[model samples]
Target: MTTVTTPDAIVTAARGWIGTPYLHQASHRGIGADCLGLLRGIWRELYGAEPEPVPPYSRDWSEPSGDERLWAAAARHLLPGGAEAPGQVLLFRMRSGGVAKHLGVQGAVGRKPTFIHAYSGHGVVESPLSAPWRRRIVARFTFPEV
Candidate 1:
């Protein structure tokens, strides 16, 4: 992978994994990856190392504990902001009253905005940032400038 230095580079790297199969906690491109795995993969491509070791986690890892573990971790490694520009990391709450766990990379902005994510049944896809999906967005972050 080429060095990822700009937001455009981040978006390009993420878009390159468009068809990767979805597998829980896996990060290998074209083989399998969950939402977080997608982010991890991008981080590796950009920085050549993971910011931190991610312990094994289940689909409902933090539901019982009611903790925002994923959001907390993103905050630790990503730049916090409300910018809706391309390449931003988006955090979503899949269900009301639950932790925000779902993640996606912003792919486009302006009319017909889209985001790339690894969906369970659909593998990796770029989906329209529709109103229903928009409502679930809890936080937006960008990769630190390297």
Candidate 2:
């Protein structure tokens, strides 16, 4: 499988998005990007297109249905992470029992880990992979095949 696993390239691409406003259901490279849009933007940078057409999803992924659809979809397409390196996708569960809905790109690892993400109120910002955030991580994934 062709993969663009370069950490610098991924980090650089994500860094370019700093200050982009958060707009849900939108994925423009610089204009507006939500958390998923940030990842989708990087995917386009490395692979030219999103791996699959993201179906229209609510911020709540059908809470009444109680489905882990986003996680399941990530499992289907993106490369899963366990022994992960920099540039991998980090999926986070915002609350203890909430769905795994946040997406961040692993910017660095080892002592002082960091990740880049476009938060709802916080635009595109790079935050430390602090204990609180780390505790919320439900899954980690890497770029898809190029």
Candidate 3:
């Protein structure tokens, strides 16, 4: 059976992961999860299994190679180019000319937008989509319809 998921449901599921410790390449809820791991966990919760197996990655995430691997993977699996909405996946370029690496789930929109993400040293938390963060956003996407 195809499971229908809502944006609110996605946001809720992401919120449920709050406080998960940051662990490189890990995706277990409440135990450890990196930004991508958080998204991977949410995908597993929404769908039965991941669409593809994730290969081991370093914290730098292909930065030295300047490959847009994360963005490419998202575009391959997610519905790309969606309006800013709760549950939208956000891809961020942490530095100028850097390969987009960071990921987050839109938690709120409008005047005071927020996003849920697993930040190193902070775990999973809802953070304001502040100016600096907003400026770093390179792409927006929504989960595929299952």
lDDT of every predicted structure (CA atoms): 0.92, 0.82, 0.93
Q: Give the RMSD in angstroms, all C-alphas superposed, for model 2.
A: 2.4
Model 2 residue 25 lDDT score? 78
Q: What is the lDDT of candidate 2?
A: 0.82
Segments in model 2 whose C-alpha atoms lie over 4 Å from true places? 1-3
Comparison by lDDT, 1 against 2, better one: 1
> lDDT tens digits, residues 79-106, model 1?
9857688999999999999999899999
| Whole-model lDDT, model 1 | 0.92
The residue-by-residue lDDT of candidate 2 on 1-146, one tens digit each, is 11464777888888888889888978886689999899888877777767799878888765668677878878887877767578888998887777788889988889999999998887898999999999999898876545
Ranking by lDDT: 3, 1, 2
lDDT of 3 by residue, 1-146 (tens): 12656898899999999999998899999999999999999999999788899999998999999999999999999998558899999999999988999999999999999999999999999999999999999999999877
RMSD, every candidate, angstroms? 1.0, 2.4, 1.5
Give the candidate number with the greatest lDDT. 3
129: Cα error in model 1, Å = 0.6
Better of 1 and 2 by TM-score: 1
Q: Residue 64 CA error for candidate 3 (Å)?
A: 1.0
